[model samples]
Target: MEMLYAKWLFNGKEILKGLGCVSHNNMVVDLLPIKLAKKTYPEAVVKDYGEGVLFSGFVNAHTHLDLSNVSIEPYLGFVKWLKTMIETKVQANETQTDEAIKKALDSLIKSGVCAVADISNTLKSCNYLKKIPKAIVFFENYSLRKKQAQEKIAYIENNIENIRQTYKMKIDVTAHSVYSTHRDLLGYTMLKNNPKFGSDLFSFHFLESEFENPFVNSRGDLFEMLQEKGLIDNQLHFSSAIEYIKSLGDIKKGLFVHCVHIKPDEIEYLKSIDASIVIAPRSNYYISKSLPNLELLKNSGINVAIGTDSLASNWDLNIINELKFLYKHYSHIDPAYFFGIATTGGYTALNLHIGFKKGFYAYPFFMETTTNNALEEILQ
Candidate 1:
């Protein structure tokens, strides 16, 4: 048995001082006051970590590991960056892609990420994710043409079925985004994955860019791409992406990624549905040069989580760096709050329990610093 004490301790909920944790066999047995821990575990070895914060390992709620090899810089715009990413993937051979994924996984582990909610356009990452301690692999789907919705759905279903039969792993099929996936395809996927069908958790990219609004209303470059294929009608007028998605069915249990343009009313609706909002601030700024209103999200009492997005649009796959970026920009919000978003909020989003409790794996992360500002020190 061992007792570890730190100046500050986050028990996956709140930060407390003069507290410590006791663990054995990689499991956290209890969290108690430092003095009490010393008394209760008198024979146990004590490691007093001075002047830093110790907390649960990070849970990266969203990422695209397959796109790890794409360039992080040279982003002209959201659409252009996306095109470049697609082109890069098309040109990358299997060996390069595998190497990129392996490198990304190594970086994540070194950065102390204990759980991941990874989005994959291909099944190649599955072989590596199975070796991780905790991960939710989301098979991505994209179909812009309405006529191809059924075909895409059939293909995705078959792919998911084959994945289950071959790897025997729990994989979730999710829509790429509102603009990339046809409404019919989203509805079909949600219906098929509903409890009556398979009870699989649904995930979708919400409004991650301002271009999404014009595309959904049939007027932007994205819409023009679809128009070239004769997919959408020029006369059609659609509401906000949130409304269109709600019009289809219940998305309360689903995971909504990015949400950079989510409105106030939409926040309430999302909260009502018990949906999770994943904020990729760095990726948002990297692609669109904009970020979601962090103040608005915090005031809405919604469950918000942080994600590093992908190396294609981010500097690295480190969740700590994402938190540091947020802290540096949104200095008003308490670092402890962001800490919750990085740890508990992420686990909650993925529906995984990784709190520091008895029988739970004690995936603790520590940082050494002179300042009591946990977030600032971690960033440094």
Candidate 2:
């Protein structure tokens, strides 16, 4: 048994002072006032981390471990960066990919991330994720040709089954995006009644770039790129990316990543579906030179979360660094709110229980601080 007292303690939901957590067998048993903890566990050892903040371990809601080796230089546009990523992957080998995955995992663990919702095209990181029990592997699917959708689905299903049997890790399937995946493929994965197609959790990139809008409308550089690759037909037509996704069927209660280009009505629609909006502000800015309309998301009463995206688009995979970026740019929002998003919002999106409560794993993170507002200082 051990007791840990910190200047500020975030118990998943809110921040409190003069509180200490009691741990037994690597699980949190109780959280009470420091005095009460001392009285309750008189025989237990106490360790007070003065002038610091203690909170639940971070949850990286979205990342691509396979793409961790890609360059982090800011691209002129999202499409240019994506094309470069594809080219870079062609040049990369199995050894390099595995090494990059190992480095990314080490960086995440050292930075205090306890859970992750990793997106993977090849599911190459399945072996690594098996060691991190809280990880949810999102097997990505992208096929713009209806004729090839079934084949792609079969491959994804096979991979999912194999991963489940071998690693025993949580797995789910998701469309790459509205523009990148065919309507038939999206419908088959999201609307099909078969147990194989249904997962309680689903995630997809949405409105990450303005080019997606024009691509969905069949009138942009992205559309031309698709045409050059013979990925889209002339018959394709959608007013907006969000509308096209909504037409697929109900996709509520899932992580909608990179909602950086959504509008007011679309925000309301997302809220009506009870979706969790995950914003990777740094990645958005790095690739597209734009950030999400956070004020709109906040005003709409939507549940917001944070993600590092991947080393491809981000400088590092630190959730605290992501929060600091948010606080530095959007200073009006409370740091506590961002903390909640980094902790509870991420765990909720991954379908895992927050560990800050009793009986759960007490994987607490400590941030050095001197100010009374430890969260704010940590962000600084």
Candidate 3:
């Protein structure tokens, strides 16, 4: 509603005192040219700090904030932690959940995250997200048993249609994980959906753990687990993690989460498909005691994004903190480049727009590396 100036804002290229001003509502608004700056009548005026780095809001491409109500503790292994998570579900009640999700969302927003490609297991937090103008939800589906695939896919497809019609916010279906989703189900979703439904930018976990690698390649542990649970039998044939996805043929355009155990050859294969990657370093460390081979992904010319996974596996859903952790652990990573990954990379992967107009802009005061500008001073 009101006009304000920023030293810079990201476009195809960065603009400084350009013909656009950030609106009071935080969406980027077009302004009169710098030459007309003095003549433009203003209802209210604000000045740029002239030194801070201003850019579009960050996009967290992967998260499970519904589990935000759960407490995080050190775990022994991936499967072990998952078991604990299942056991603790009954203990996490509404009050704790409300506090955690609300706080996590607040922290993410304050750190300048405008959009998230969050995975939802249910509609519990759906209403809360609907209330926010920025956040979006992707209801994820996870079914490993081959027989259950069709029914589960139908449920997801119907649920997605329902959510889109019901809410003003955007909603989509994220295929759970390479190991968790059955081959037939993946094929049906990609085939039946076609241009509109199939290959609809599906998100899933891939090669995040050693156990997953074998389970997918040879129907190992998870297969055995399913068998023990009476979900599957010995007859179900399985393929390699990436191979099963490749078998889908036409499905490209996707987000692959947590490639921690991803090999060099697998990275090459992923590169062939042209899908992007979202590395949840903190979450990876918390669950698997490992981090992704960012060096490999970067070297392969793969576009990388960042995500603060759910509170169950992550301590906080703060993108700034995630970026900071990335900077600290991976010393070779440039802060500006990593910031771009968090914003532009994520936005492009999920097909979302960002600008000052959306209050989806980030001001990285730390980029200067000299002045610790107070929040008010830098924002002004």
* All-Cα superposition RMSD per candidate: 2.6, 2.0, 4.4
For model 2, where is the 10-residue window of minimal lDDT?
83-92
lDDT of 1: 0.78
Ranking by TM-score: 2, 1, 3
Candidate 1 off by > 4 Å: 42-47, 156-162, 191-193, 196-198, 229-236
lDDT of 2 by residue, 142-255 (tens): 878877887987776666667667767777878888777888778766664547755556788998988887787788887776677677754457888877877777664677
Q: How accurate is candidate 2 locally (lDDT)?
A: 0.80
lDDT of each: 0.78, 0.80, 0.66
Worst 10 residues of 1 by lDDT: 190-199
Ordered list by lDDT, greatest first: 2, 1, 3
Off by more than 4 A, model 3 = 1-3, 6-44, 49-51, 157-159, 190-196, 219-231, 234-239, 356-380
Q: Write the per-residue lDDT of candidate 3 for residues 1-380, one digit (tens) a residue.
A: 44554444444223344544535555444445543653554554655545445555667788887888776585556876765765575454778777777787787767767677778877566767753445667767767676577788777656666677776576666667755677766665544345446546677787777777567554566556555656443243345677667667766677888888777777777777777888999888888678887777777777787898888888788787787777667766544566667777887677665644344443322222124332222222
Which number leads on TM-score? Answer: 2
Per residue, candidate 1 scores C-alpha lDDT tens digits across 260-285 of 88899999998887888999998988
TM-score of each: 0.90, 0.94, 0.82
Q: What are the runs in model 2 whose C-alpha is more than 4 Å off?
A: 131-133
